[model samples]
Target: MRIAILGATSQIAKDLILSFAAHSQHDLVLYARRPEVVSQWMNNIGLVDRYLVADFTAFSPAEHFDALLNFVGVGNPAQAAEMGASIFDVTLKYDDMALGYLHQHPDCRYIFLSSGAAYGASFDEPVNETTQASIAINNLQPQDWYGVAKLHAECRHRALAPLPIVDLRVFNYFSHTQDMEARFLITDIVRAIRDKTALKTSSDYIVRDYLHPADFYQLVRVLLAAPATNTALDCYSLAPIDKATLLTVMQDKFGLLYEIQHSGVAVNATGRKPNYFSKNKYPKEFGYYPSFSSINGICNEIEKYFMQDNLY
Candidate 1:
């Protein structure tokens, strides 16, 4: 298959690119704002001259691609907050670009990298197929912009029902390629372990499902092979993990030291999510079942990270 990957520099996109190159015979054309960086990264990974790398500006409708995956958006909460209202523009711009190509090539399947944030701020429980998006339209916060942007894109895709597009609402994702300095709980734990310092965190009883790269790659492959459909699918693992369990596992496995502060840590830039995963089993219909649970996936990736850096 000829696949076009936008925002190819993203961590998830890079992981998928590696997986595709190593595991499949797909011809991948990478589109990024910084094409040189993508090329350099490919070189660093010993993937030199294996795929075509082009700038987003170079994307043309005339190009032939069986699948186009849009990973073009803010990668982290900090980036989302920093991007502000521009998040909507960034999402719309690339989505419109993809839509234009879809209009010309209806056979091409589009897989958008959406977020669990699209389900909105009320995640008291896991989201399911019946769950509706909740938004405070009258009182919009900076935290709400990213999710709203993604939801807006999904709405547009649904409206174009005839087009073959699928939005994957990813709740949590982690890999060895993740930015260690990023302000995520897992990244914080990684940093602490690497530096051999105590991690200060809030005692928020949050639940998350971290989808491993391998499972995510399998999901994408399944989607690409499935019949054309215009709908969204929630990404999930075999099981989700809670804050206490995650900390305990870290301590037991990696000698992690941590303290819970009564004052609590600052809220994430994308707002708080107590139950940030989904209960939707829709992906099973497409023959994609995760092989790793949240804790196990986290441990697997962290071990890879340590091995890569010789820190373990």
Candidate 2:
């Protein structure tokens, strides 16, 4: 299959690209805002000759593709906040680009990288297929914009029911390719271990299910091969890990030092989500099942990072 990947420079997209190159015969054409960076990365990883790198501006409907995966969006909370209201425009732009392509090639499958934030601000419990999105239309906030943008795209996809589009709502994703400087709980833990500095974290208990790249790739592959349908699916692992357990594991295996503070930890731009993952097993019907549990996946990827950096 020939696949066109938008925003191919993203960590998730890069990981998936590597997976496809290493494990499959699919031809990939990577489209990114900064194609040079992706080209350099491909060269560094010895994949320079294996794929084509093109600018997103060069994305044309004239090119035929079996599938199109849209990974274009802000990666971190800081980026999400910085992008602000423009998230809507950026999302709509790329989504419309893909929709236009789908119009030309109706048989092509589109896999959109959505987020659990699309479920809206409150996440007191894990989401399921039955869970409806909760949005405060009268009281919109900056944090709501990102999720709203993704939700809007999903809405548009569903409205175009004849098209083969699948929205994968990822709650939490961590991998060896993740930026170390990024402000995420697992990254903080990794930094603490790497720098031998004590981690100071808030006492706000939260549960997260970090999807492994392998599992994510499997989900995408499953969706690509599944019967055509216009729907959304929540990404999940074998199980989720709570903050307490995560901290304990990091401390034990990685020699991470951490102190819990009652305050001063920065809040997420997308609002507080005490339970950010999903319990939805809908993807199982499409023959997708995670091979790693949250802790196992975290350990596996972190170990790979350590090995790569000679930190172990």
The TM-score between candidate 1 and the true structure equals 0.99
Task: Give lDDT tens digits, candidate 1, residues 88-178.
Answer: 8889999999999999999999999999999885888888989999999899998998999999999999999999999999999999998
Query: Residue 265 CA error for candidate 2 (Å)?
Result: 1.5
- Give model 2's TM-score versus the native structure: 0.98
Using all chains and alpha carbons, the TM-scores for the candidates as numbered come to: 0.99, 0.98
Question: Listing every candidate in turn, what is its Cα RMSD in Å to the true structure after a full C-alpha superposition?
Answer: 0.8, 0.8
Candidate 2: give the clashing pairs.
none
Per-residue error for 130 in candidate 2, Å, reads: 1.3
Which regions in candidate 1 have their CA more than 4 angstroms from the true location?
A: none
lDDT of 2 by residue, 1-312 (tens): 999999998899999998998889999999998999999999999997899999987889899999999999977887888889999999999999999999999999999999999989588888887899999999999999999999999999999999999999999999998898888888889989999999999999899999999999999988888898999999999999999999999999999999999987754889889999998899999999899999999999999999997986
Go through the candidates in order and give each one's C-alpha lDDT: 0.93, 0.93
lDDT of 2 at 175: 96
List candidate 2 segments past 4 Å from native. none
